[model samples]
Target: MKKLLSILSFGVIAFSCQQQTAEETNAPSVSEESLKAHIHVLSSDDFQGRKPFTEGEIKTVNYLADQFKSYGLEPGNGDSYSQEVPMVELTAMPSETMTISGGSEDVVLNVLDDFVAYTERVVEETSLNASELVFAGYGVVAPEYGWNDYEGLDVKGKTVIVLVNDPGFASGDSTFFKGETMTYYGRWTYKFEEAARQGAAGCLIIHETVPAGYPWLVVRNSWSGASLYLDQSGENFQPDVLGWITRDAAIRIFEASGQDMKNYGEMSRSVDFKPFSLGLNATVTVKNKIKRDQSKNVIAKITGTERPDEYVIYSAHWDHLGIGQEIDGDSIYNGAHDNASGTATMLGIAEAMSKMKTKPKRTVVFLAVTAEEQGLLGSKHYAQNPIYPPSQTVANINMDGITAWGPMKDLTVVGYGQSELEDIAEDVAQTQGRYIIPDPDPGKGYFFRSDHFQFAKVGIPALYASGSYEHMTKGVDYIDSLNQIYLNTQYHRPQDEYDPSYWTFDGMALDGNLLMEVGLRVANSEDWPAWKDGSEFKSIRENSMK
Candidate 1:
């Protein structure tokens, strides 16, 4: 009996050793060296900041294709690695000043200073000539929340001035529109769309730094430059003009109308808040240089051995602000941390996947999308015209900005509780001696801001996360300070250039490994992650699967 027991124990020990060896051998090699090389090249001036519809686009796409080919990855699109995305470039030149009248006194807001406006219309010119202006609170119409800012208000042929965020942010009540966590209703994109649906001729949001999650400078720099949009073809509802006004500008306009801006802002926090006319008229014209063009979404994939029909996708936007308003005498917005890091990380994962000893059972695709800075147009186009059916596409793992601040004790998942993908991510994170946390600053609406949101809208469970906020060695405060510096100084600015001096990739490598393992688990298994019950995307996915 003792000899038999000894033999069984030996067998168990041998089996455990074999399993560990297999895991170690099959683990993807996501290296810091690879990540740094990709980021440095992509963010270099030679890429011209990787803007679409420019020489930068040509250089960037070709480089990505070359890298994928070098890694022995097959083209994702049939017979080609590039997917053409049709777009229209609109360089709107608004009038020097927006004039307000019919108030106690006329007030003129300077363009790019106190106000910034642009039009999505494809026409050469559009205008708001003395359009009646109404204050429409947050411009949100959520039936579930029983809040309707446009109720009983006819804004047709008029301009609606709304607040940037929703009432939940103002009230800080979790039951009210998800509290400080900004919902889609709080996003400026939603405000404009709602205004257009209400038949408003124009929509302007009042920008407050904290609620907006960015300063006036970011607004000016982003909106003032040439913008790109998916070729609308007159299919969508877009107001004649969409814009933003600084808080100071809003105050002046309100004062001219004999109303206190502070009081109105406080009142907007309530669900019963009603829309009212500001007794003012706005006049402005936007002349545009319209150019229709095509951008490329670089795609590469590895076909699964067992389940080639099912897919797992990885995405990162490869576009940035490009050459724009000069800041500190530098015009190139290198977007090193904005997206180059994320793109590099994706490439690292691709390299590791390509070198795997055993390929995943489900097809794995690497999608490097374009024009995300211009409101996620590349991803939007792909979602609308998908190569793989959304129902068959198992999941999308998106990487936006990757932290350079070394490894973290936790991974921050944007829109944390929305999907079962979070559960998978949590399991994978635990293997690395790390944990998962929801985004600390949900008021930024980051989940909707990135390319993953497009996939989510189409019912594909998407995961966007990074090792952030709690550095392994530096702690939380260190990460926060770095984030603040990046937000205040480098974000969307020319100063976003990569400097190897302080930038580190150990953390990025850790994140890449985590993402790779999660995707591998999904791709090799028969699981299709579903959205959580309370997620807004849950119904869309359920209906599609049916």
Candidate 2:
């Protein structure tokens, strides 16, 4: 009887081991509880809005490194997990009012109310003293589109006022500069760069609610404080002033110049539009308090057992607007949804990957970039001075934000048709009984807004996607209404705090799982995803491979 009892106990123990092995063979599950916990800590006020060059930055980077170490990930950089990004912080205090002359009548515009401006030049003071003003249409110079708002026009020593978005947005013609979808030329940064290249003294973008995708208050809030820029080693060109003016203020300027603003706006929709002088002169001075410092991009990696040289990167920005002008008695821009959620999602994915029983074939990197709000500076630095060869880098999957409105039936891919990664994402979405969709509003230029754009420019296939639009229990309308509310009231404001009673994490978990599976497939496979034929990045990738 004793021998028989011993035999049964051994069989039971063997069977339990088999079951545990089977569970380990499958992908690890992403936990909503884990994600919520991470978001709660990162978005807390103690982080001080996670701004670079502050105590907030020190805490944020250290926390990320600690979390990665806990997940068993090795430091991505040799002997260190932080990549130092050199930057300059410029706090510009402009004149109280900009005075305009050489028009029908002199017009004075209030600083923050009617307009907001700043200088990227590393100088103590820069001024536009009676600089001639020109209306440069969209201020775009795209050779491929056969459009040049500054064609045969000299803007040297002058201030140019340009429209907010590209002409294709106004015409809605699919053949015209990518139709309603904004190209790189439509971005405000591109406009400023082009103006500086044209030797313009200053550039002011006219702000329209629909075209600019936000109210004037967003422009005021974002540009009013200290702004960060790449040190550039004094190589890049920057205008004396870069700014935005309210629609009302723009109208007054146009009226003073004896040109109907509405007529010029209509004419700008055509490719034949030409830049013309507004017959106005402007005067303003900016005093800058500049500080040069170093910020960090936190990185960690799970080295592949097989092809360790090739890599698949997952990236998210860890910086926000920081402490600013108080609103609603709350001075912290927690960036709960704007990016803390994304950083948490990356952490959740890293934990899952670290626990995988069967490791990936290619190295997987988790990168938390800095100064995305200041303009994708960390990623830009990495792209320019890559630790890994761009040609050997397999792909990049970026998360800017994750939905908190519960699970969704569809995943929206920004820059949907740019590469073959979307195809893989679609297949992964199907496994979860979800479909893939393109961004509903492409004119906002979201594809160019995030860190992924830096990778794309350097010839790597990158995917920026999330599960949004069609909720599981609530319909599409419900999701749309929530998005509107968030954008109008909370976006870029101090009120963008985490609220446990209102926020949910199931949706974030689902999206995180989908992204993890997509990345895992890429990491284990031998095939390198290629850019779609007409993609602007195709040539760049092709040349790099050669």
Candidate 3:
């Protein structure tokens, strides 16, 4: 009888082990209800459009925390599911006025119609009066590439105006700056940062709708609202005035400097390109008031079984254009595809993984960041002040503006040619009977604009994949038209609301599965993914790994 009891116990143990193994290998199926439910709640009117500082933020963050708790995810930040990202929300509304003087004749560039400007320095009172202006060519500093735009120039007490993209982008030459693919040097954020480092009182970027990827109206709409930034604790960070000037205004300035706008634009692409002081001068006067407020970055994590110290992070921004000035009587900019879908998808993935009978070998952090619409600020904060050390974090899987259309035959990696993450992505895609495709417009610079960039800057291999419209059920042409319509009319506007009828979430599930596979492969492996050869981030990752 004792022998019989032992045999039964052994049988039970074997069965349980097999079950656990199956659970670990099998992919979890996501539900439509799960996706819709989360997104609906997040984009609902009661959430007040999920703006960071308003009651909207409170409702949205609490909902995210409750959902994380329900999924059995551990609090990501020391017994708390939410990280209180202390931010000073500033709203600057300046009356339109800017004056410019140069040459024998004085030129005054009007605000709103000609240019847009704002200040990062939190001051009760500020003004820009007759500030000397310097034109910085493609405002970039890449020591590795032996390029410097501010060579031996003191920009203090002066306003620096910069061209839009990198030299390679402007030059249409592959050998110049990463070619059409924009380096971080091409990003507006980098331009502002370089100017700040140079002690420039203010920095202004020339805006071309094609290179900047949106119209000046889009810029105005975005900057008109409240801007959020991580509040500085000490005196190390210096804030400066940041703004943009229209292409026509830029052309006028170039003409005033006795240079043809077309010739200068072409000249900027050459390796011999040097920062020249545009003989024209620019002056602007601004008035603004500042207010301080706070926001939250909702975070949750599932600890690993073997390597809990190491992590895989999945992130999406949760905030969007909330309660914009009414356009055609529609006030709420319900950012359904802009990021509610991405945020909801992250939670869905978290829920699916958390329900598995066996835990992963590495921790998975689901981060729903704030103010990506404002300029990747929340991700910037998390990257600099990470909950887990960046070196231990394997990679960042980021989703921004996921497709609402149905399934397709391909996946689009924003920065396709940059790193080895594309290889892993392709391997996963093959399993789904899909393939990987590069962004059609490398010149558009979608890679630098997303939240994944923050992680990439800190030497983490990051993946920014979204659904493709090439083979949707409605046909490629229809799918393409739909996306173009969204881009033309709805992007960053009040019309970005949920449309249950047209938005087939079939691709959402597929995208989620691909993300799951990528994380699983990274989580279970002993190896770390690295950027490819000649990539700027490759050396950094190698050093961090060592």
Instruction: Give, for candidate 3, the lowest lDDT window spanning 10 residues.
Output: 14-23
Model 2 vs. true fold: TM: 0.95
Off by over 4 Å in 1: 1-25
Which residues of candidate 3, in runs, are more than 4 Å off? 1-24, 103-105, 233-239
Estimated TM-score for each candidate:
0.95, 0.95, 0.91
* Per-residue lDDT over 449-474 for candidate 2, one digit per residue giving the tens place of the 0 to 100 score: 99999999999999999987998657
The alpha-carbon lDDT assigned to residue 183 of candidate 1 equals 94
Q: What global local distance difference test value does model 2 have?
A: 0.90
Error of 3 at 15 (Å): 28
- Summarize candidate 3's per-residue lDDT along 1-546 as a digit string, tens digits: 887787567446533543443355564655567888887788777776788888888888898999999988999999988776777767776547666667566766776677777776666445566677787788888897788888877788788888887877756568777788877888888888888888888888998887777878787787764677677745434434678888888777777777776566677656677676666555554455555677789999989999999999999998987787787788888888888999988987888788777778899899999888877888988988999998999989998887878777678889886777789888777666567899877877888888998898889999998766576435578778988888888888888878888776667876776787688778888878888777677878888777
Model 1 weakest lDDT span, ten residues long: 13-22
Q: lDDT at 331 for candidate 3? A: 82
Error (Å) of candidate 2 at residue 144 is: 1.6
Give Cα distance to truth, residue 86, candidate 1, Å.
Answer: 0.4
lDDT of 1 by residue, 164-269 (tens): 8888986757987899898999999999999999999999999989989989999999898699999979664899999999988999999998977776767988
